[model samples]
Target: MDDLRRIDLNLLLTLHALLAEQHVTRAARRLHKSQPAISHALAQLREIFKDPLLTRRGAAMALTPRAQDLQRPLEAALNQLTSLLREGAFDPHQAIRHFRVAMSDYAAHLVLPTLVKRLRDQAPGIDIAVCQASREAMLAQLGDGEIDMALGVFPDTPSNIWVETLFQEHFISVADKRSLPLRGKLSLAQWLARPHVLVATRPDADNEIDSALAAQGLHRHIALVLPHWSASTKVLTDTDLILTVASRTLDPVLHGQELMQFTPPFKLPRFPFQQAWHIRRDSDPAHHWFRSTVMDCSRTSPQSGEKQAVSR
Candidate 1:
């Protein structure tokens, strides 16, 4: 008996539309259900709660006190449920969709241009909004459903977010051609001694170079800090101002200019850069397309030198 009564969930949805509109005809249109169906649902709700859910004043029907109490929360719950059902199975090729992706300025330096091209080629009508930020806030926004995806080296975040490895890259340094004092390659020592710019601004960072420097019991001096890798790269004019970056992404941005690549002075662990999205969107077709597309772009990015093999 309880199961039977509990299973008629449609009544709740109908009740939601009825209490909100306060008119049988309007609620029917809103629910795509007939006026008689709404009237029947109102009766069922009255029986369930033992209260008239709505009352009439002239032609306008006002919600009863009980209905008013239940209105907003009920509407919010229904809206969330509807959003859940409608979230997935979005087709990229035909659907006009815009998705927001969060990434660091450094991460964007390696992947966005190619990702954009792929999106345009595969789904012309689709659009992307790239938001660059630190990993923590991005992950929080992802959990709260404010952000759709986050890109970069988010190696060990929580389990609720899905991380797809985009690439594992060998970090290196780049400098302009006219700027090179001497060189086919600069040694790790020379790399470390030069004025280097780090793309980290946050107070605490799991910085890749710190690990690299720690390995050799040495550290690079930070001459400047930029919010994005693009700015750092462009700032590496002809001077000896060296830019620490992933080797895989260096060549693409280096237009055969006087730029150079060198191994780091110390043995630092390479970072695995991945794309993350909330688990809720795991089955979403458009999100699936975006994930695969990012992986494809990262893997075939000739600019990154070696293709990063994706792992889950």
Candidate 2:
């Protein structure tokens, strides 16, 4: 405590700039200080640390072992202090951050394009890294801080997770026009007669569609079980297999002449499409801004509403 009290905070900032740049002139330019000022701070830092923190190595300066040890902790401490000072103020236009998100291909297709476009226009410095994972893995990643957010149908989340409904999504069936001549709607008998393509992250387990069918004491033969919703619709082009998927995932199929869509013959209720994050991030300004931007992008879908939010 005595050693800490003896050190000046301003000198530590100067040391950070110097260590990051490794050159007096460069560090001065970075901190907007004169080269002499940085040199003076470097001298004081060396005295305080009782060592030459930076030593000349050929044409460039390199950090001494002691300086190298302090680099990461010093940077983290400064960042935490900065975050504390700006807790409630987040300027998207000036913020440079990278966010990791987890979602299925269906939800990515529904929201990413609009989300990216909006980011380009409003928050150019922000970048997004998306990963695809099963529901269980997504929730686990959220809890571990491996992912910043997740978008999908998440139910019965833990007390530390928060969910905001982006929209209500319903399923629709699609089949190759060449294979199934009928359009508009199919009777339950016709639907059961045709082979179906099931898109599920876990192929072994039953999905909502299968559960819905089983409730009525009926079942459809799943000829193909695949995880890619975006590519599953194309599989129907040359086969008799039918794919029942989220409505937005079939947007291209709706316009293409190769395939046709019809209402699901069973009573599969509309599920809430949602975005979830760890409660630890609930009050973070950057995270709050990003969640709001995602919610705005979700409005691009034709049928979006039922604004429900639950946090614990």
Per-candidate local distance difference test? 0.71, 0.82
Score candidate 1 by lDDT.
Answer: 0.71
TM-score of each: 0.62, 0.68
Native-structure RMSD, model 2: 12.0
What does candidate 2's lDDT look like per residue over 221-308, in tens digits? 9998888987887778777788888888886734378888888878899888889986545546788799989998998655544433
Estimate, for each residue in 1-312, the C-alpha lDDT of model 1 and write its tens digit. 875565377987778667645678877886788788888888888988889988988867877888877865675576577668877656667888788888876667667788888878778888888887777888778766677888877755754466766766777767776665565476766666788777775645668777757766887787887776666677777667877777655546463665766565556677677788765455456776777777777775543322222223
TM-score of 1: 0.62
The lowest-lDDT stretch of 10 consecutive residues in candidate 2 is 303-312
Number of the top-ranking candidate, with lDDT as the measure:
2
